[model samples]
Target: MPNPIKVVLVEDSAVAREIMQRLLDSSPEVDVVGTAQDGIQGLDVIAQTKPDVICVDLQMPRMDGLEFTQKVMSDYPRPILVVSNAVHPSDVDNIFNLMSAGALDFFPKPTSGTATDYEKLKSALVTKIKVLASKAK
Candidate 1:
């Protein structure tokens, strides 16, 4: 990417937010312009930053990714990527719901442990963001 893709992250866990930010920031192709703890704050950040793609958690305080995705699509119309570990349902209802709510993609929240884990997280996250960024354009 000639210019880094502007991104907004909406996650309730401070640790998860920080980890994801670091992962995204590791790639020169991605620029995490802003982050919010929850969807209400996410709305404000989204409005201010006008990111090219948004990364959101499915389960959050104040508002969940489903509602957040709905609002963002109607109000701002950006590509949304729901990165969450919320796929416990046998049928993967969370994934379907978020997709219907207008998320462009979904990924399991990356787990950090080994060097390979970090490398995999970096590649998958940046690749997803790159793909979603194109959808927004």
Candidate 2:
């Protein structure tokens, strides 16, 4: 079997981080190797872990996601999947801007309030990560 994809999650909210970790753990093809609470810590973790994919939050403390994405793209150029609660239609332009800046794609914060919500999003997340990771390779 192919090696499981290594993922580093960088999210500030405790609940959101736990939810994401749980979802990622459910995937057989993916592994949550490390996690960070902010962009600075995320950067450190990325450097240390060298994960195949990094899931980051846009509004983190100590260095927001956009800045981190810019730096990572400029230097590391790894696959970055942005997770955010900014789902308003008005934010589409800004989201596009993030995509242009570096992030491969963005996903809505899972709010299903149950395991089913995570199960649905997990499939999409895994597909996205696999595609991006393959391209990065």
Clashes of each: 0, 0
Q: List the global CA lDDT of all models.
A: 0.90, 0.86
Candidate 1 displacement at residue 91 in angstroms: 4.0
RMSD of 2: 1.5
Q: Could you give candidate 2's per-residue lDDT for residues 1-137 as a string of tens digits?
A: 89999999999998899988988898889999999999989888988899998898888889998999998898778999898886344798768778888898887876656666667788988888898789788
List, residue by residue over 84-116, the lDDT tens digit for candidate 1: 888544547777887788988887786667888
Model 2 misplacement above 4 A: 87-90
* After superposition, candidate 1 runs with Cα above 4 Å error: 88-90
Q: Which model scores highest in lDDT?
A: 1
Clashes of 1: 0
Model 1 pairs in collision: none
Best by TM-score, which number?
A: 1
